[model samples]
Every structure is written in C-alpha cells, then in structure tokens.
Target: MNPTASSGRSPWPYPGPRPGDDDPAGGGQTIADVGEFELIDLVTKGLTENDQVELGPGDDAAIVRTRDGRTLCSVDILIEGVHFRRDWSSAMDIGRKAVAVNVSDIEAMGARPIGIVMGFSAPGDLSLTWVRYFIQGVREECDRAGVSLIGGDITKARDITISVTILGDVGPEGPVLRSGARPGDLVALKGRVGWAAAGLAALSRGFRTPKAVVEAQQVPQPPYGAGLEAARAGATAMIDVSDGLLGDLGHIAQRSHVTIDVHRSALGMPEPIRAVGQATGIDPYVYLLTGGEDHALAATFPPGALPEGWTVIGTVGESSTPGSWAVTVDGRPWEGRQGYDHFH
Candidate 1:
C-alpha cells in the first residue's frame, strides 16, 4: 500500500496479500525499539545445536566438524522486494524458505546438510519477537532436514535481507557434480515441479487458490530423502529444481555436453498444474517447463528404468549429435522463461 494512505506509513504488501486481510506489523519495530544486542540475544535464544557444532552462535564464526574428508557447501540470499516482500510472506515463511532452499543445494549434491550460517539485516526498528519467530521457522525446518544452526550474525540495515549458507556431508559416498552425466541415460525427478511458479503467478495476479499452492511459493516441498536415494541409485548428474525444470536441465545438458529431452506428460503434478493453468489462462506446461523453486531432484540414470517416485522425464542423447544440448516439452521445441537471474 502507499505509505501516505496508511497510518503515516504501512507494512509492505508490496507484492499484495493472500486473501482477506493485511497488517502493518511486517515492518517490525524500529532499531531504537530494540537495542542491537537485545535484538541479537532474542533471535539466538532456544536454538537447537548438534554435536558437530561444538562452538555456536555469538562468536565471530561458528565452528563445525567434517568427519569426512570434505564438506559440500551452498549459499542463497533472500532480499526484501527482490527475492520476496513482506506482503507476500510471513517472517516464518521466509525463514523456512531461507533454510529449505539452501539445503536443496546440498540435496542436489547428493549430501545431507548438517549446519547453517545465516546473515540477517533489517531496519533498526524491527521487532525482536518477529526475528525470534523467523528463527523458530528455521529451527522447525532444520529439524526436518537434520541440520543445526552453527552460527550467524545480525545487523541493522535499510531493508530486510537474509542469507543462509549450508554445510553438508556425504560420508564416503562423495558429492554429485554437473559434468558426470553421459549419453543414453534416463532423466528423472523425485518431486513435483512448477507448483512454486504457479503459486507465485497466483499471488502476482491477485488470485487465491488452495493454500497448498500459496505455501509452495513461500516454502517449497522438496523430495527430502530423494537426493541421497538418487545418489545411491547411481545417478550421474543431479541438481535441485531451483530454476525451471527445463532451464535447470539445460544446465546439466550444457555442462555434461548431452542433449536432454523432457517427456512433459510424465510430470507429477499434471492435474493440479493444469487446473492452475486453467484458472489463470496459461498453459500448464509452461509452468512445468519454466517454473522453478520446487526443489525436485533431477538426475541422470544409466540406461534402465527409473526408481520409485522418479519419472523418466527425458533421455540423454549424444552431445555430438545435431541440435545437441536441447530441452523440449513434448516433440516441439520449448523456449520460455529462464529461471531467476540475480543480475537482472
């Protein structure tokens, strides 16, 4: 809402609301409302720690152990009005998403995330209670992912921004990489795709569907154990569906120098996606091909049938062949929205 129209100023629904009501508290209190040390203290209370995090929260950096020889790490940032706005998400929602997306990278690498490092910045007047609630969401997700909070920092800034870096371990199995795929392999996924984008579209258009789709845009439902399952299933190249499936698959295709063909009909959420498309007047396939942040596990399986929950979305073909590195929905060529580009 426009600031002047509100009580002097208002909270951002800069993106709009879910349905019935909107509130101004999303902005929290000003910095003077809670002193920095007090604010920091509030956010750090009641966190769950792990054995690996011997020293956590409050030091210059948190310390963690890697019993294995190496650690896999991934980082992600959510910025106000950019990655998300208060109007579209709650503190708890953002916190859960901040953690889930970071862990999805670890999942993509065929590892289990063990720890997190967070950096948060917000206006000086932000509420200590709100920050604490955000951390509660993080803790809730960490419990699901079996991760612990090693450490993090808090500071006042012009806008609300949060970044999380996850540290994961794969034990003796090692991590999966982009270039390991080859020709003649079946491409597959473990979770739903395009739902997050569908939800985002709904929010953008002032529409409200099931809370399931709305929650998807706030925090995706990833295939929790599928990453490691794929690794054990002999998946060669693997990635999280952080970007649109087709676009992300393009990354693997380009990196592995293989052609990727997606069997669009096999996607898991065809019915729901089509329903969303019908409600919004968009092609449901567009959401599957270009929507992202579903955190589905996409991988290459050596010539064979797929595993349970895994669909053979496409096949890998020789890169040397004509029109190699191509990704299509159905037999026709598909060129649609690429995933999020930070520089844009």
Candidate 2:
C-alpha cells in the first residue's frame, strides 16, 4: 500500500499556482519575503480542533485536556542534511516523517495521541510554497493519527530544522514503561522492521527502484493502533523501533534487568529488503537486526498473552552478569554496530 495514500488525502491539496510559477504576489516568494506572522497565518489557516483542544493556535499557549489526568509527551528533531535531504524527498514526505517519529514515541508508551506543537526553522531563502506543502504533509499525518495540530513556532535559520513535541493520554492502565519485562516474557513485534534501513541504503547509493522500501524511508507507517492493542492485551514492556530492533530492545533489557535473545529463524526478511541487500552486497540480517526509523513496535508479554498483529520474535531471560550486553541474536552477541549513533 502507498504510505502517502494511507491518509486518503491528497499529498498536495493547496490550491494555488505551483511553486516558482508566474504569479506575481505569492508564487515565488521566499520565507524572508513572506515574513514571520504571514507564514504563521499560512500554516495555521484551516487547522481544525478536536474535543481535547481547549484553546488552539493564535494565543500565547495552546491548551489540551487530558482525560486520564496523565499526559505522555515526546519530542524529536529533524535536521536538513542529517535527517533528510530536500533532493531526496518532497516537502510533504518530510512533514509526515517529522510527525510520525515523534508520535511513535507516544505510542511506544501505550498512549493515545492528543495533539502536537511544532517548532520550525528554515533558511530565509527557502520558498514559501515548500513551507505550504510541508504543513500539508503535517496536516495529513495529524489526520491519520487523529491528533490536532495545536500550535507551533516558525523562524529563520541557516538550515531547515523541524522539532515536534507530541502529547498523549494513557488512561487508567497508565503508561507502559521499558522497565517492566520479566525473565519469562515473550518478545513480540508489530509493523515492518528493516524496510526503511534498506531504503536508506538504496537511496544513499543513488538507487530508488524498490518503491516500497524507498517510500518506507521517506514516510514510515508506524502501526499506530497496535501499540494500544498490545498495552490492552497486557504488554509488560514496549518501545517503538526508531533505533534498530536490537538497539531499542537493548533498552528494555537494560531497564528491566533482563537479557533478550532474538531468533533469526523467526525474523523473515521481505523481498524488497532482500533485493536491496543483494544489490548492495550487504547482509539482509544487518538491516533486520540493526535498521532504524521503521517505527515498528516491540514489546514483551507473558507467554500466551500475545495480542493480534504481533509476532513473537524472541524470549526474555535473566541477565547472568550486571551491566553486560543486554541483547543477543541466535543466543550470541551481534558482531558489529548495534544501531544508529548520532555522533559515531
């Protein structure tokens, strides 16, 4: 399925002359020319509120109500050359990705997202139309996740940077923490794991043929509903697969003071990822074990407590030594890099 089409909304819904068109007033204006308040107006125009929103944008602060008396919050930032490249993705894709990653954090905690506030900074030379398409992407993703775009700030900077903070409610069951896994828990996962990493490899080498994997990297489809379902089904611990599966699971192991062993036979590699591996001369398991940005959910549940849509991929065991390696594949330590490291 087309990830962009999942929202059932046009990727570019703005009705106007295309970017760089011959329009004298709006079409060719840059961020500097449009100014800050006008850009805010362009972004907030037509934004709708949900039942949780008490006060939407235009005020000093936006208000959101929490039904559970507890709010779950997560923040993530995407930088221009680091997290994305303009030549590689459309403005809409970047916008969707920015929201998707942040919200995945909310879901990992077994919470329902209520709203998002964004902080956008871009070079003054950036085109106004690009900003419009970016916000359109954000709106599409917000609709897909059933969250409100309450408010955000825009400013001038040297590079385009988007910072998003998502708020969610976990209800009476409370938030699921990474530290709850027990020795006998079954490790399960929902959503695709390695596709985005394969997509990144392909894009890095100037190949984009495998449309599925490529699009996965551009806009991840984070099985948003599965998190809540897993929580309801008695998940002991959970996390979103933003980092590689092993790396994120390592967090659970460290926090819960257990060791997790992933079964290689259980992790089936998709055709697109295998194809990418074959073309790039990289092992498919590398992507499966250490790939990041897929936003898949991984959790530990009691035996026979597996929920629908989740596949058992590993088992949790007691750690023999304190402060030791927390994750293993096929009962041994992984040989190379565990996952993405920002400063590595």
Candidate 3:
C-alpha cells in the first residue's frame, strides 16, 4: 500500500519539473486513470514545505500540536469551474490563494497557523513544473503566515480542485468564536471588501479593470497578522468574510443572537469599481455585501477593539428573532434575500 493510503498517492515518483514536459497529465491516460498520488506529485513538485511541522507529508497521517489544548482549524475548497478556472488563474496564483485564504480564516479566529494540509485533484495532463510552482506558492504564503505545511494528498480527477485545511494554535488567549459577540459590540473589519467582486465583474463582462482590481481576483493579500492583532486587541467574536458581508455577518448574527447593521457611508469607493457597477448594472452594495473570496476579517468588539487597519462597519443589536435577519440601509428591517445559498 502507498504510504499516503486513503489520502492518495504521488503522481510522479521523480523529483520536481521535467524539462520539455508541458502538461499535468505527462501525456498519458488522464489523471483519474492514474488515480491520486501520481497526480498530486505532478502538481506539488518543488521545494519542501517548512520544517516547523512535526510530520511533513508521506505517512498514514500528519501531526501538529496545540499548546493551548484547543486547535483552531478551518477548511475551504475551490472547484475548478465554480470557484476558479485555470484559464484565468496561473498555477502560482491558484496556489497562493489556496494557502492565503486558509491562513486568513485561522487569523480571523484570533489564532496563528501551525501547519497546513492540502488536498489536490486535477487532470493528468498538467505539466510537472506547474506542480512545483504551486508548492512554492504555498510555501511563500506559509512563510508570510509564520506557518509551515505539514502535508496533504494528491489525487487524479476529471477537473482541477483544491481543498486546504489549516491547523492553528489558539495560544492561551482567543479563538474568538461567533457566539461571543455581545449587544453594543462594535463591528470591525480588516482588509478591503468588494474589490474581488469588482474584479470578477471585470472578468465576467470583459471590462478591463485597473491592475489593482484584476490582482484582487487573482491573489488576495489579506491584511497579514491582523487576526492575532484583533484577538490581542480583544475582539469578542470574529469571522472571515469568505462569503458576502451580509451573508457572512449573518453568521455572527445567528451565532451571537444579534442583528447586524452595515453602514453604507463607510464603504470604500473608487471610480473604476463604481464605474463597473454602472456598466454592469450590478449594485455596488451587492458586491460589498454579497461578494465572497475577499477573505477579509469581520469581528465584533465589546466597546473598543479598534486596530490600525480595522474599520467600523456597524453594530450588534438585539436578535432578529422579531423577523429581521439584517437591518435595512435606513435602519429599518432588512428582509431582503439572506444572500449566498451555496447550493444555488
């Protein structure tokens, strides 16, 4: 049996990158036909993950420790055609995002990442160098987050898919869960919102966005270390905005049993995105409130938990049990669509 077992197998037994080879498949039976390991090895070719991890790849399982007795972990998956497409994103960009977003979630929890485990499924035709570059992307991102990648599985499939699971140490302090927000808690956010949606709009409509917007879609550089800062600064409850703001805040609301009111007055504005809204006839609020993949941190504070990069978005109120999941723009009952239903 392969060492990885159920996790999958290495696609290529040879080391990183084969010159003149230009595809993930290695020009043979499709990736699914080779199964998992071979395909993962093909894509993950490259420099080793950080040495911090106790067990790095190739085993029945990988191991990392949680000194605080609690482990803060989160997982996010990207489907080839749904979440991202190889056509728009390079292997490196995809790799970077796969790592960055996971770290962002760990940060949002008010913890620091200890290690990462990744699961990749792809076609057999991709090139070997592509895999190495992808790992490099993960390593570079892990370096930024002060974490190392322990290991993960590689598999062959009909399409490209990446699932990243991050493990974090809660330290002795926080794991600011969603249920901790209290009434009168101040709403705060780190990292810009709506930009990724704008970039997606630009791509979908073929609108040439400024470099910044396009970059937003390709690789999101969330405010690094901000989650721990927020935690240390005393964030009561926190969450990462992987979903739209209203949609994500609904999480805080449901967990904290409060109503969340978003202030439109404080929104970040620029001509290109506003112009994109006008051109595409899509509401900017939709982008601001419903867009996902921004991976920004949204947390609640008891009274004053303001950090340098944090912005006040709104407040936590009595539960919406009276029939309002969110507050209206004008402070009335927000009874519109609850936003983002993953199934449809």
Candidates sorted by lDDT, descending order?
Answer: 2, 1, 3
For each candidate in turn, the TM-score is 0.88, 0.92, 0.84
lDDT of 2 by residue, 1-344 (tens): 22332235443333433322334344687888979999899889999988998988999999888985788888999999999987667778889999999889988998888999999999988887788778889999999998899999998889999999998888866588999999999999999899999998888887655878988998899998787888888999999998899999999999999999999889897999999899889999999999999999999999988998889999999888875547999999999988899999
Model 1 lDDT per residue over 187-240, tens place: 988887888888888778765454467668988878887888888778899999
Query: What value does the lDDT take at residue 54 in candidate 2?
Result: 91
Candidate with the larger lDDT of 2 and 3: 2
Report the CA-based lDDT of candidate 3 relative to the real structure: 0.73
- Model 3 scores a TM of 0.84
Clashes of 1: 6
Model 3: how far is 263 from its true place, Å?
Answer: 1.1
Give the lowest summed-lDDT range of ten residues in model 3: 1-10
User: Pick by TM-score: which candidate is best?
Assistant: 2
Most accurate candidate by lDDT:
2
Q: Looking at candidate 3, what is the lDDT of residue 153?
A: 78
For model 3, residues 1-344, the per-residue Cα lDDT tens digits are 01112234235322333222355544444444555666556544553555446676677788786775687778989888887766556667778889988998888889888888888877777555566566666777777877776777776677778899999888866888887887798898888787788878777765435546656887888887888899999998998888777778888887777887778777667665676678678776677777778788999987765778788988888864653344444365555554567787
Q: By TM-score, is 1 or 3 better? A: 1
